[model samples]
Target: MKMDLKSKLLHAVLGAFFAAASPVFAQETPNVVFILADNVGFGDMGPYGGGELRGMPTPITDQLAREGLTLTQFLVEPSCTPSRAALMTGQYSIRNGLSLFIIPGTPNTLPKTAFTMGQLFKDAGYSTAIYGKWHLGIDAQSLPSAHGFDTFYGIPPNTSWDSAATVPGVMLSHSAGDVPEKDLIDKGPWIMEQKAGGELKKVKPFTLEERAKIDVDLTQKSVAFIKEQAAAKKPFFLYLPFSMGHSPNLPSKDFAGKSRIGEYGDKIMEGDHHVGQVFDALKEAGVDDNTIVVFASDNGPTGLEFSNWSALGAPDMGSSGPFRGRLGAGTEGSIRTFAFIRWPGHVKPNTDSYAMFSIMDFLPTFAAILGKELPKDRPIDGVDQTKVLTGESEAGARETLLSFIGADLVAARWKQWRIYFKDEVRTGSGHLQLGGADTGFIDRAYPSVYNIEMDPHEDVNVGGNFIWAMEPALKAVMEYEATLKDHPNPKPANVTNFGGN
Candidate 1:
């Protein structure tokens, strides 16, 4: 039948509607908000174990576990910079010549040639902003702004370097008015400012009152950034790496005395509240739907037994939860961490995945989400885990993971079994022993093996039962080493020697 004039016009209008809006509606880019906690232990939160914050219940992270997908076997490097490198570049820290935190006097920096997550998202048409600790590097070219972020406002190096005692002239000009505030607070707050391609400048001499407020300030900045992008109807990536739970654990005044466990518990509780605020901001800005929120700790807890925190003036390192080792060790307790993804409508709520997951997996996973290809010229240790992250498939691409201490391949995890080539125990001394392979060398006639699935703490050496688990791990190392022979680790600047950058 022949259509009348009105019917024909309506059909034409409808066709134009879908044509104009289909791309935006069908595959609109999802915004990403990555929240990272520093050196949080396994049993620190409610879902894992320490959610009560020593009986003070961190409702925020607990609620997130209730609403989002928690990866029970999430893993990261035992330390900071390496974990950051893997999360950003999908490669081991050694591959980028970054096996340790960028010390203040050291000239270490991640090579300029490395591609990063920030660059990837920005290249894919997302506005990227980082508002928190950036320990990767503080050199001329190592700033976050240089690596695909549109804005970089956070601490560089770390508290160890940023303190007034370490950096000369760190304390800003102050008077009696700032003294009372200073008395209440400790340490100075030094903020960094940088444009996408501009110079890196540290805003010196911010008040001591400022240190106590930095976490809150960073949280607000992150929320504002998300709101601004949401209002502009643009996809964005906000990386908020918290600087809490580290030594001299300083929680804001609001959370200072809120926890029963002391400084560390207070800091964790503060972090939990910040997380809740971030999620709240997403909902308030009307971008809750179609947004992917990932929450995880940088690594495991600090020290093996933190019960001495009371006299040491350190925060509660929390329990190892189900694991045995702590930070600084190559044990599961130190490497395996808490992780979750909240992608509305895409990921099922309250889903707990036992599949092996790694911070390195995010690069390829986000690449897949944006329909972009992973870099082909360089080696990418990260496997695409979009299917697992989105809950579409319970099986993920990661089947094995390598645990390291500088150049030492201390432990290797293959499925449920683990093999330890070298003895790695997390102690104050052990962490200090990092930076070389010979530090913790333990030449055992027979390697130690454990079934992680059956013994989460890695207490039972089931090598006799799973005797075959050792070859695959050693084979994995051999195969990886073989590739490096031809690739020859270019060994970027500043891994060890100062002024090397």
Candidate 2:
């Protein structure tokens, strides 16, 4: 009953073609729960090799991996905002003018024109809600409610964790009477919420203490949403973007000091517990076998190399597994992280795929699976990855992904080759700043190349011998440029620079 590689590829291609041509059959639609962990490295979880080895036990997530397919080559944008934009829009973040992280009060925001996954599910008759971390924008047009979610809750609208540290960090940095301390601390960024077609409202000040315990509230809301949807027998889409492992890694009081590794370890352990709670809710609702669960990190961790660990009183920060560099840098570890997909009977359990899957591919893949059509008005970077996810194709539907850091195409991955356009070295501080680092880019005489399959660490450059590989990588770049000629991107949002087109 087993088909050979050629036959499988042919069948997959034909099946995709026929499915697209035929009218959507009245098949069972599975509920979707996508859990996006921020700043989690590949080696941080039990399944990918962290867990107890790193003094953090993640038995719950480990079991999730065992019951589904784990991706070894899942790729994402270099940082949080870009990765999340790509996930929601099915386009490169640059296309949406969101290539950089949106700083508080900056002009940057998710454009009102972009189509999102929340809208996609809502149009398909699924109840949709997003809990925890909507870093897209603070304005009404950019919030989750505008994009199609029925409800959204978590951190302040349009700000990062730095907003939580504002009470002392901002209040103390400035002279007294420059701004009232009470107003600065008390009226600072608060936990915010919004319902569809409703105004975004503040709930409570997002203090350092609240930040430590925010994940618990997010998890509780998600469980309630799932239960509510199940009671109504409606297909639902739940996007749980956890605020764990980002920075100032604070675990709840219950999990504090429970891990051997420090605050960072405790946070991951806490995240594991919350993931288990969501899974249990699905089972208790009797939707366990009829739902698709995707657990993935937006990007890699912030290793001690980028931050001052000694000052934070933590022996370690985060692990990039076997790769080099951390979250902000242009390296394999920065973009390549963990992703697991579980759909009970649909996805084969305990399998691993080395397919080149990008975060942008989710929208189109979900559309295809749900028998919905993607908008034809704009260029969608994501390809249909249904065949890959359904075990019909071992080789995924995509081979190339371009990585950008504020309009600059820093790197490109084609097949097993990772090609770098510039040489970037970390400059001691500014790792959490706008551009990801206080580094300078050196103009390389020739592009650096690494065969990722052979050299996972990117220790050696084989570009001289494989100069021909750069042809395909550059071709991908040229093709993207060609698209910009007719359908140009909006000027990218940059506070420091004014030279984007």
Candidate 3:
């Protein structure tokens, strides 16, 4: 084993060359932690506008913004299930029969054929898991575990934060003689868990009291997952959808009276605390530098008139920043929200991108990063935005995004111009209200166009003066329609069966 200096130097050079060329010697893939906030608004967090003003000081979120890239014109669908469907499938929710929020026992369910973000990561040699809401469906075939997530925890299928509000009192008034309280409780929602290739199992009853503390449990479980993956030295993808921003915004015991505003503010502050905890966990596990942390909202805020649960205190729902309309309407406020990405070394810090980014873009963008090929059989609306994220280009890949409510395309955004094909009006009292419901749409003789950058509130319609804008806007619509010839969307869920077929 005694080698001369010349022989030793030659061996070292050969070893270095092999290490540089071999796939086995490549660097580890980056891990992704995506935290999805439910109905959190553009002006709700500190960096956007409303931190101290709204009595919710989000120091953690502000720090994250400073440490990474902030997306100013980030857009999403108007409601939960549709937005979530877009996020998961990299396409318009209408393509998957989930363009509206899915109600229990309804015909709308996630189609089995639709490919998901989880499956993409799973195929890329990353350990994937989703904790929190799984509103896609309650069916065994449609659960997160079935769709390529290695683990699933939190709310049961098709249920949301309000599922915990059915208590034995004034609101949930059942016929005492006909329906027993015990029987109702047994049939109520519970915190569920499942692993890949396993059946979903209930962990505990998700009562109103449990709802206040569910986000805490979710944070704990997510932290554990992070630590476990770090120890194994495995690349992982964690999707944590927090329940804080949704109405009945009850905070945990520690953050109960922390905010000067009402229950919603308290919950917002609690969300900040949870964000800090996850960041700390990543740092402690020594995976902070290699992990990509993303924070974003599912949609705009819920209105005071809809699902106003003042159980613990006043539900100061949310503010839509400078925009006017709330969750449902096809207005700027309804679709525009906040998004932050902190990819330590890859993304420049304290930078802002005004480029229009869609929630659906995550899937294709992630696919590009992981070197995965997308399925060629289906049409993917999302474009690869790796260049934008890495600062290679200022203008993003997408220029036009079509906004749909259920099966109908209500609006379309092209560059800074928003063209509305239908006028939206909020329904009066005595009308049945849902998240993206209670808003009647009337067909317009000519599409109304608003330069969103100039008219942030959409106050002035320049459709008459800038009638030429209709050509490009309508062209975007026409191009999407042309795709229907080859790849028609699954039949509308309401008219068809539950599977969206």
Q: What is the lDDT of residue 447 in candidate 3?
A: 87
Local distance difference test, candidate 1: 0.76
Checking candidate 3 for backbone clashes, the offending pairs are: none
**TM-score (C-alpha) between model 3 and the true structure:** 0.93
Give the lDDT of residue 58 in candidate 3: 94
What is the lDDT, from 0 to 100, of the residue 272 in candidate 1? 85
Better of 1 and 2 by TM-score: 2
Candidate with the greatest TM-score versus the true structure: 3
Using TM-score as the measure, name the better of candidate 1 and candidate 3.
3
Candidate 3 lDDT score relative to the true structure: 0.86
Task: State the lDDT of candidate 2 residue by residue for 1-501, as single tens digits.
Answer: 999999999999999998886633333588999999988998898888999999999998889889999998889888888899999999999999888878886888998888999999999999999999889998878999989899999886577654677777766677545877678866778898888988888899899889889999999999999999999989999999987778877789999988987888898999999999999999999888889999999998876553443225674467889887667677898899999999977799998898999999999999998989999888899999887888999998988889888768888999999999999865555544322344456768789999987998899999998999999999999999999987899877576765443
Score residue 419 of candidate 2 by CA lDDT. Answer: 97
Error of 2 at 295 (Å): 0.4
* Per-prediction TM-score to the true structure, in the order listed: 0.86, 0.91, 0.93
lDDT by residue (139-182, candidate 3, tens digit) is 77678987889999989778788878665552356545567666
Residue pairs in collision within model 2: none
